[model samples]
Target: MSCHNPAAKIDIPKEAKKIVLAGNPNVGKSVFFNYLTGLYVDVSNFPGTTIDISSGKLNKDVVMDTPGVYGVSSFNDEEKVARDIILYADIILNVVDAVHLERDLFLTQQIIDMGKPVVVALNMMDDVQRNGLKIDIELLSKKLGVEIIPTTAIKNEGLDKIKDALYRAKPGNRIEEVKEIIDKIINKVDTESEALLLAEEDENIIDRHNIKDFNGQREYIYKLRRYRVDEIVDSTVFEVNQNASFKTKLSRMMLKPLTGIPILFVTLYIMYQAIGVFMAQTVVGITEEVIMGKYYYNFIMNILGSLLKDSSLIGQLLIGEFGLITMVPIYILGLLLPLVVGFYFFLSILEDSGYLPRIAALVDRALTSLGLNGRAIIPMILGFGCVTMATITTRLLGSKREKFIATMLLGLAIPCSAQLGVIMGLIAPLGLKALIIYCLTIFIVFVLTGTLLNKLMPGESSDLLIDIPPLRLPRLSNVLKKTYVKSIMFLKEATPLFIIGGLLITVLQYTGLLDSIASGLSPFTVGFLKLPPEVSQAFIMGIVRRDFGAAGLNDLASQGLLSGPQLITSLVAITLFVPCIAAIMVIFKERSWQESVLIYVGSFIISFLTAGILAQIIM
Candidate 1:
């Protein structure tokens, strides 16, 4: 079958052409995207999928960026998104890491076989030469039947040639045997891209095209293509030195058990000091207490009180205890904002420096006992940022079983940064023993719950298969940009929820519902958990937002309503309580309504039971 264009499948202006940037993970695709599009970029989920795609303008042409993938097929959501974009784009910018030319060429060849117009960006050229490797750019271009541009994306080298190379892009030569097999199925398939996918036995494409299954043919075609890719790399690339560098030695140490474990703890300690001690305490005190509490809250409440009077319902709604003016901004802007910034900033540094995957590798074995691989660490790490966003990210896990276990763990055990910060501040004053007990209890719960679920849940777990990128010094500009974007996204998503939560709390208070619920929960609070009845109010606030609950507890502790043991018990209970409303909604969206509800109910039981037992022992 001749190459068929799938560009017509998606709607775009007739005059507008698309240039898609595609490559394997950590191949500098983002750097290229930022270079081409600069600061003007929009990140959104692709239609009908949770995978995010970034788009921006390059001169008059629309430039699009796809999630990183090894090859173009529906092996995962990211690959599916990448394949769809490649299918629809007018041209492709295939970024290849020159140092890993042999490994990256497989995807490069797959794109070529799709008959899509492609310009090869042989990226990481500086890394190549620094490691004493070389590539014959012209020879590689000639072999693939596409233009090759050697680029060091970080240094902004050879980037200007990209625009001109777009016009010089060409389809890669196809394998004759594979072509023959595709020709036989040509009448059934509509596009060359679809044909290639079909030949690879892609179920999604086959189902979409209503084509017959070609199961055995895929292995044959894949092997043939792999052979061709090997031939291309062998002929066009040369490596001068085989000696391991310090980075290589460090990478080895990071993957080994003894060294890696200590490294992991040290890393966590550093993060805790940076985020928990410095940012959460020092930065948050200024932002939440001095700025928001002493200034903004007072300023706004005074103005609103004068305008509507303290007894007025409008005044209560605006500036009262549960008022939007008093609580919402303080919780979101003053409290959560600093924590989110600090968390994302630290995360971005780890991500850009290529340390995250190594950490994942180190933990893979331990996670396996919980029916997860190191891949679970991504969402777990992100859960520390925001469990709601992490729930959505659980889709990256391989199976429904993995996703369910991960989601449950996140909902039940992982406290978001905002809540963590407040919890730390509250527990820190109780002395080191209290703090250690608090952390140890949560960690024990996390492992035990995961182990229990692993046994109960059906299906075997998948192993971790991840790319380990070379460590590089993080770019300040890139790290700051990601931090800014993620922070803005957090604010936009969180602000409205906080306002709604504040309004809901005010209405509840005004209608006497808050008091009634607190009274109703007194038996559970006072009798079961061995805490003051007033602590029930914090539990109610937790349903609105996790941080709100923790902050409420902080307020009660400040007033001396909770003792050291009571503080520890309450912190543990709230930490494992029903996930905040936002997280529950996301769980409902990502999992089913049934699953979300079960998780909600299950967490409440587990949290209360655990806390009840702890309160009895500790007190």
Candidate 2:
């Protein structure tokens, strides 16, 4: 919903025509919206729904973008919002994927049957050519009875033609059923759009218009409409070659479990090198130790030191080790920022190249065993970057049971990017054996916990129904834009959390509460976990930020405090600990307070109990 704009809410001129851009998912509507709107666009939450509607101006016409849907119906919030805007549209600028003529044309035909003026942007024609498919544009135009502008949205080809053709858009051919339905219901409804939706048995539309009652013809109408679309596609599209392209062949390899699992590992290994090893070890070493650790620290302290010299208490709060000015920025910018940016950059590429969905499809079987479909992998993968953001992504899952299970797993097992970086660094010196132990332990926990939850939870996971767009080289400009915006959002979210954590720690340290708490946790920390009392301090810090906890352990390791087995045990425990404050807050926001508390307490007990058993054997 976000990351693209510093866009101010724009007001449409009262006299302006509302031009809607509608299409199936991944048909390149956003590209067209960006080109047409230039740098200025508005994303406003549609009334009475959580979905946002984007608007920009094209001359006197107001260009709006709706969620990509097969048809406008009230099945979901996305469809309902799209249905409303589409209903009110003065002209529908339908963007259709040329390669998906039969599938994409169904919605195009739906709009046409509603008697709404619409212009078709027959997009991805370049893909159509590369895939060895041909479409007769003249025949398609004549068949649909609308202007069909073949466009390659990425290359900016035929865009101007689409803009110019808007003025010439008119209603296309209507089927016999639509004409008959309109004749029966036109006097009852205010608009042709409503009549079309009512014919489809749209409950919301029927309620709004106060329809007495009508028999459901939705299934029959859909069957006929699909038949009509297939008819048009049969006449207009042709296969130029019988052979599959190389990309097509590779895509198949990506879907099969045999090749796909290895490909997934290679992708994960690359990500680990880039974000965990390179960004965490190399980039953070320079930024944290050399830049912020020495130069910026000394410079800021020197200038501010003299200013706060008179009040020792004030100086301790502002310039102390846990000071907001000292620790917050250092951690957020110097330590975490590079890792976050790297992770987002990699994620954007997976999304843009269309490989993310393939990963989901490949893992569907494995995830199904965990009471989740392949689609749940999106949030699971995202949980590594930031559990807070991933919690929001859980809304994408179909059922309440799936969302609850996904949220629980994320809170319990997944380590965020910042924490993952630090954890990787800790495990690096422990060698390959320790690394394997760590991976095996976490993997076992993930599987065992998920299986138990599946048995305990009612209802079944929904099947993965996702789009797999033709894989191609991702556009660099698009990828970078996504990375930059998402990184900015990360900084914005992390900044406040770090500041509050630093401030709270400063207060606790000054009041002697931190030491007192550490003393109080001696039974659990020293006796149960068999770690030193100082390790309790890191556990406390881990509550604020998991990476901070791991970094604290790193400091202990640097000082030659923790033995190897103890270090490994502590690492396992901390990695499985309750999520950081940011993630905890998000869990509370996403789930009920009862559920949130249950996850937190459950993770705490599981983390220590599991790690404690390992401590007995290893240490």
Q: In candidate 1, which residue ranges exceed 4 Å CA deviation?
A: 1-69, 72-200, 203-243
In candidate 1, where is summed lDDT lowest over 10 consecutive residues? 1-10
Candidate 2: C-alpha lDDT: 0.85
* Candidate lDDT values, in order: 0.86, 0.85
Q: Would you estimate the TM-scores of all the predictions?
A: 0.71, 0.70
| C-alpha RMSD of candidate 1 | 9.6
Instruction: Report the number of the highest-lDDT candidate.
Output: 1
For all predictions, the C-alpha RMSD in Å is 9.6, 9.6
